[model samples]
Target: MNPIVYAIPIFFLMILIEVITTIIRKKDYYRVNDAINSLSTGMLNVTTGVIFKLGIYTLIYNHIALFSFDGNALWVWVLGFLLQDFFYYWNHRKGHEVNILWASHSVHHQSEEYNLTTALRQTSTSFLFSWIFYVPMATLGIPPHIFLTVSLLNLLYQYWVHTRHIPKLGWFEYVLVTPSNHRVHHAKNRKYLDKNYGGVFILWDRLFGTFIEEDENYEAIRYGTLKTLRSWNPVWANFHLYTEMLRDAIKTKSWKDKLTLWFRRTGYRPVDVATPMKMPDIHAYENYNPEASKGLKVYSLFQFAILVLATTVFMTISHNTPYGFNLLWTIVLALNLIGTGWLLEKYTGLIAVEAIRFVLSGATIFVSNGIWINLIPTWAWQFIIVSGAVSLLVLQASGIAKPGSNREGNTVRAAGS
Candidate 1:
């Protein structure tokens, strides 16, 4: 069973508790559009992972493992956990240092707000290369189950540290990763830019000289990337950096730079394509919090709830489904997320995308003879159809389908409009 299946409910419960805490404290920490956008990226990552998860680790373990260890041994479990953490530290650090890797890892830091949802903002493409870092555990004969368990545990450990409500721990700060340490990791301030890369333990950062304390008195930490992702489209968020890098590679005069630019340091740019751009004042920056109508917000929340349920269904049954069905389902889910983002951003002409999604969803059921996703009962699919139809009618009635609904002073237009 996927460990994330069990943690899904707990993740939402903690978010609910944090929401209440922030409300009682009268702090403006959560924004509906930003939270939903963060979650959209997460769903994209999860679904993509489900379809593309490789088995090279198990193959290597079976064929080339140096030594076999007893899976049930206590010490073996401890070793596996430590190994996963060590690998995660380097994977995360290199993710920030390398240009191509940063293209994938930056999704986690694109959010302008620091909240629990920010932890869910992940990259869909990191799986392409991240597994290379963990191959040593497989080669050393760590059982696949143990490695998987430790990985899930390490991931769950990092989730809680994304919140702002938690303060600095005293002695615990010196040992394990805490909220304070991770908040510094997500900040764009000069001092906190690439600090605190540990997943579960802060000792690695301290030992490796990457640790930096969160001193709010010296300068209030501003969140997000230096090149802000001003749009709420999750699909665009994942590919924007890659697109920029590709454009740079094409524009550079040197063939060596063109072929090797992605492997170079994070901020490296070719001399020919390097244009001096003004850096934003991090201390006085504002978040990309755009104006959203209450009706649109409610509609987005309702649609997101449906997507969450659909994602649960996807995760539950994807392992047993055929590759073709999984690929089709992944495409559908990606489009659903994109449409949700469009609604949240109040992007005009969403009706066209919704029409495509509606058609694909209907075909997913009909082409598979209504048995493609067995977890979703027939009644549930009917309910979704009814709900989507009603939503479309209501959206059209509210003028959301009109071309000028996203005019200035009313709603924020989509990026590049």
Candidate 2:
């Protein structure tokens, strides 16, 4: 069973509580746009993982484990958990220190606001290299099942540390990756950058000298990368760094710098192509907060709810469903996530993307002789149909639609457009 499936309800429930508490206290920690955008990235990560991760992980583990030790000792679980965290610390630290890895890992750190949803801001491409870090465990003869469970445990342990509501733990601060310690990891301050890389245990960082305690004297810890993403788009959040790398790789005169720039230290540029790109003064930089109308927000929420429902069914029944249908809906869900971000940013052509989404939802439900229809009650379907119809009317009146009439605007593909 996927650990995250069990945690999905708890995630939303905790997020709801966080939103309420922040509102009651009048704290600016939770933003509707940012939270939803983070969830969108997470949605993409899981939906795409079904295609990319499962087969690769199983194949690699099986090949490496035929001669592997089958340790069922109680200590194996505990030892496996500890060993996984040790590797995770380095994998995560190098993800920050290395250029190519940061291109994938930086997506999680790009959120300006620290909240529960920030935990869900995951990378779609990081798995490309992350799996290699665990090959030692496979060879050491730790059972692949143990490695898999421990990996999930290590991941789930880090989720709570993403919150701002928790203060430093007294003695646990020395051993575990407490919220205060992890906050420094996410901070962009020169002092905070590349610190506290532990996923579950702070012991590794303390021993390795990457630990940094939160300093009230320095400045308030700001959440995000030094080079801000400056947009709400999740797809761009994943690929923007790669695109920059590729663009730099194309422009550099020296083939050495062109090829090595990716593997070289992050932010390295050939002197010819490098210009003075200023990091925003932290004190003066403002968070991205585009104004989305109430109607649009409601429409986005409705679409997201339906997406969540579809995703849940697919994950539960993926082995039983047709592979083609699974891939189609997954890609559709990913595109709607992009559209969700565009709608929040008030970008061009959101209306058309959303119009296409509504059509897909209706078609998916009515086709296959009510395949999706059986997932819910008839009354619920009637309500969704009425609400979806009203949503289309609202989208037409929202004035965000006019751009769809233009060929260029309709096809605009870049982030922050």
Candidate 3:
């Protein structure tokens, strides 16, 4: 009953359409590195969910809540959708207003571009608190299957809103979250900060007095947060806020401040631990895009695409594959993703890590033969090996991997640091 699994093709199709539209319009709304970082973040979330999500379902193992209506199917789903939306509004709003929650949620806002890719840039650790928000549904005896389905639908509804091409829908803007409304939510502009915090419905914001209409004099909406995440690494995007929070917590002398910093309101600064951070000019700031050569871009894209394909395979066939193979494959892919991110960011000496990954790719083939050989056809395996080796050779031939004496010019930061 996983609608998202079935919708993967549609998701990428829409992304493709958006890319084509960008080309037709002669706009640069999408960047290769930014989109790849977002996709990687999303893939990481899916992989981790496979491991940690069981704990959430296990919470309502066998207990029935107050209203376990077996007869009224329509009533259950309608109620489930409404109740879930209510909880989601709070979850999303609190995620913006609270420091600890914002730590995980900040990943979504890291991208300055408002497109389908930005929609996919979700948090890897949102599960820690997100499950708690849905506990009430389980308590109400909402069937898990129905709840999961509605949740998926709820998520699907939000996808189309993450675009710039769509104008504000006339009357529909009053009730549903739309592209216009979501654009305001993603804005770091002073007026739009923390406004319009609903996932599917704008009604919650209007009722709760958290709604703001986008003013054209706010002219162009500048996306992203005041404290910008100046990196392309998806792994860093998730934990950077938490890292900053931990540092602040350690600096404060008060035991209460030390522990409570995480729970405090968003952007709370302790006087004891304060360092003057140069706040970027919100209205006039550049996106955190670093430069890489054309060869490196092509090499990085090929490696990343292979990771995406591997993740897709894992998601589709996880049930058929052994737990060990799934676990091992995910580990290898995650590690590869880290190295790839480093390479994309122009980190030097990672050519050696790339070499190590080639070795690991071969090792994975041998180690996983018993599991995947029986599951997928033999040609698929040959495709993987032949394509991977060819990509590696092409990458080496690209010559950016081995920058020789000019290595410093190509590298943004020293790799493996």
Candidate 4:
């Protein structure tokens, strides 16, 4: 079983505890749409990883690993853990310093509010090059299972640090990455930018001169990128930076810049491309929260709950299913995420879009007479078809099916305006 599959219930349980604590303390740490968006991107990241990730590490270990060590040795496990975190520090640091890398990494930093949900908001595209950073483990002959265990440990360690509720631990703050130091890493404040890049240990940042402490009096740390993603669309969140880079790359007159701009510093723009005349005041920034009604929130959650279940099913069955089936299922889930985002944004036109999706999904399964029959059970297909019909009726009964009803903005504006 995937270690993450076991961690899934624990993740939700901890998040539930955080939600209850925030409510009791009146700290207002979560927004419904924001939390949902964070989880949506996370599901997208994990599902896409299953569909697209290749077994480079295992293959390399089998073929060209220079040193062989016993997979069961205690020293090997300790060394693997240390090496994983060491490389993770550089991988994370370079993610912020380089433009193309930042394009993918920026998804993790898109949310203005930091919490446990924020920890899951990962990038789907990091697999493109992030594997290069850990190839040394494979070359050093660390068993793939040990490499995986250490990697999961590094990831799980970072999750709890995303919360503001945890104060600095007295001694742990210096050795390990604590909430205090990790908060500095997420801040947009000029002094805090690109600081504290460690995963489990803070020593790497200290050694590299990238460490900065959370000050008592300097200023309240402002979270998020200088350029905020003001929308809740998860697919758009992943591509927004890439879109900007591509535009700049296309517009530049200099061939060198067109080719090398992605390798340059984060937020680099070619000379010919015009920078925005005005930028947001980082000190006075407001979160990108569009108002949503109670009904809309419920509807969005309903869809999100279903997607979560579907994602869990995908993760469980992906290894046993054909690669093509996995890819197709991933696309359906991604589109479902986009639809859910539209609903959260209060796009009144989403009724038509979602209705079409439900109908198409039902019809596809009905016509194919059990697509994924070997993997997904027949009852699951019936449930999907039934859910589609039920959702349509719910929309109609709630009057949300009416076009332009309770709309925050026109459909075009809701999308990106």
Off by over 4 Å in 3: 55-58, 275-279, 369-385, 402-417
Per-residue C-alpha lDDT of model 3 across residues 131-230, encoded as one tens digit per residue: 8888878877887877787888898899989988777799999999999999899987777789998888899999999999977654567777789787
lDDT of 4 by residue, 165-224 (tens): 888899998899999999889988778889999999999999999999998677667777
Residue 270 shift from truth in candidate 4, angstroms: 0.5
> Clashes per prediction?
0, 0, 1, 0
TM-scores of the models, in the order given:
0.93, 0.88, 0.89, 0.93
**Which runs of model 4 end up more than 4 angstroms from their true locations?**
276-280, 367-375, 400-417
Name the TM-score of candidate 3: 0.89
Local accuracy by lDDT, each model:
0.84, 0.76, 0.78, 0.84
The local lDDT score (0 to 100) that residue 274 gets in candidate 3 is: 77
The residue pairs found clashing in candidate 3 are: 216-219
Better model by lDDT: candidate 1 vs candidate 2: 1
lDDT of 1 at 76: 100
Q: Which parts of model 1 are misplaced by more than 4 Å?
A: 276-279, 370-377, 399-417
101-159: candidate 1 lDDT, tens digit per residue: 99999999998888999999999998878989999999999999999889989998899
